[model samples]
Target: MSSAYPTAIPDPAEESAPTTRCRILAVAERSFREIGYQKTTVADIAKTLKMSPANVYRFFESKKAINEAVVERVTGEIEALIAGIADAPGRTAEARLREAVAALHRDTTGRWAGYPRIHEMIEAAMGESWEVCRQHVDRIGAVFERIVRDGVRTGEFEAADPAVAARCIQAAITRHTHPLLVSQTHPELEPSLVELVDFLLRSLRPAREPARG
Candidate 1:
């Protein structure tokens, strides 16, 4: 697949700078998906795009830069998805939290699980493009925090610290959400997604008061 949204090959004279850049990233991301990022070279991307390597570098200084853009595009999408769920009106915080966690697991498994080599793309982002990965994590964490704060406000959850609780929620779902671990680990080795989400929700609920005399 050339891209999730493929465009026709660009004519240098006709395509705007942003259009050319998007074209390069589209080809580069396809190559990374099919061939793995370590082996997908600038020349290969340029060749596939019918452009010179020099032209490819006009937008991205290095393969790493192109990969960063691709990872950002992917993460930006999931972030928006989670953010929308976090802010959806007329939903309880617990409901939103469950949906958001399930969405992350579903998105991760759908995109990376059972795809043997695609982990290379995320591995590259985690190693060489860590700021991009870290920013994505932080954004996701912020969404969790928003939900936690809502739950606290509504007296549905008790947390001495919502930020800490949010990070805990993110950490708790790593097995379900982290691409590398999800791709590599067998399903039986870990708790089921529903089981895990239910456990997390239980941890977030308010502590019950003991019966008085």
Candidate 2:
């Protein structure tokens, strides 16, 4: 018996740019979020924006181009948050980490909730946009790495691989971002931004010897 093979898809990144690229990108992001990346088409965006499909092509050659722009926009917000966290003033490395995590969650869930569909698209795009997603992840990890290294250097945290420690810290912080997780585990424990920072600080503290009897 013969088996059928999947067809190879075209890469959207290879297309040429158009004169009204910015306008097309803006409309594309809005449309994609309102409907969804899969359901959205160049024609749909063009119709919503009162433009011809051909005109949309004059801006973005294909739907993939718009998707790339959407991903970039979301990633840009995350990068900005990471940058702000790195620059924030804190008494210790752990304090900085906590503040950074809280800030990231608030910004991501509060201001950018519309991008959840875009995020889902990026994950589904796997082969098409995996590199873009990876780059953003690396950028976030770098911020955490810097905080971890600073903590270790100042005796604020125990010695460990900064890169690995950064990943762990990021994972812990991300887990609290789920609405279900926060609601179920911390419903009554509404932590102020500073309180969240304190929790991270305590977690990063070095172990102490048992008290003598």
Candidate 3:
């Protein structure tokens, strides 16, 4: 299998300021993937980029800042993917919601199953960079809200408040989607992903009309 880390860290000396910043993050993400973020020092990233630690500091004030930037990039990619599924053409709202949740499960397992140490970076972000984490959560919830509102408008779903229902759905699926839980839990021990999504979808369906006497 191809290594997830880059083959070569870019030489940031000849790069522009923004390019240098992006390169530093690239190297730092690789280092974090190889070794846990706690063990990845600013000096290590600097050495990889063939730049002085002081130069790395010019772009990021400290290790925490670098971790925040990396987390933002990773979470941003995830948000973009989920957003795409939410707005996909020619799909019903129900289909979009099901696919979006499935995508989250697949993403969590596929991305972190190979690199267990990834949890360390995520945990660090949660503990130290909560604002970054919160923004990601909020963005994801917004996507869910959009799909729920679409469903309600089409009479495919019944929700008094789409925003609240969207959050409920997000909370309900946390076990299937959370990295720590997905990594640690035995697959056979939990409800299947399809079953869970089906159950949530049932809850959102509009109530049936009263039967004739």
Return the top candidate by TM-score.
1
Worst 10 residues of 1 by lDDT: 1-10
Instruction: Assess candidate 2 and give its TM-score to the true structure.
Output: 0.71
| Candidate 3 residue runs with Cα over 4 Å from true position | 1-15, 209-213
Taking all chains together, each candidate's TM-score versus the true structure is 0.88, 0.71, 0.87
Sorted on TM-score, best first, the list reads: 1, 3, 2
Clashing pairs in 1: none
lDDT by residue for model 2 over 115-176, one digit each (tens)? 54654455444557767767877888899888888887887776457788778767666545
Per-model lDDT: 0.87, 0.66, 0.87
Model 3, range 94-131, lDDT digits (tens) per residue? 99999999998898787776776888888888999999
Clash pairs, model 2 backbone: none
Positional deviation of residue 23's Cα in model 3 after best superposition, in angstroms = 1.6
Off by over 4 Å in 2: 1-19, 89-91, 111-122, 125-127, 177-203, 209-213
lDDT of 3: 0.87
Pick out the ten consecutive residues of candidate 3 with the lowest summed lDDT: 1-10
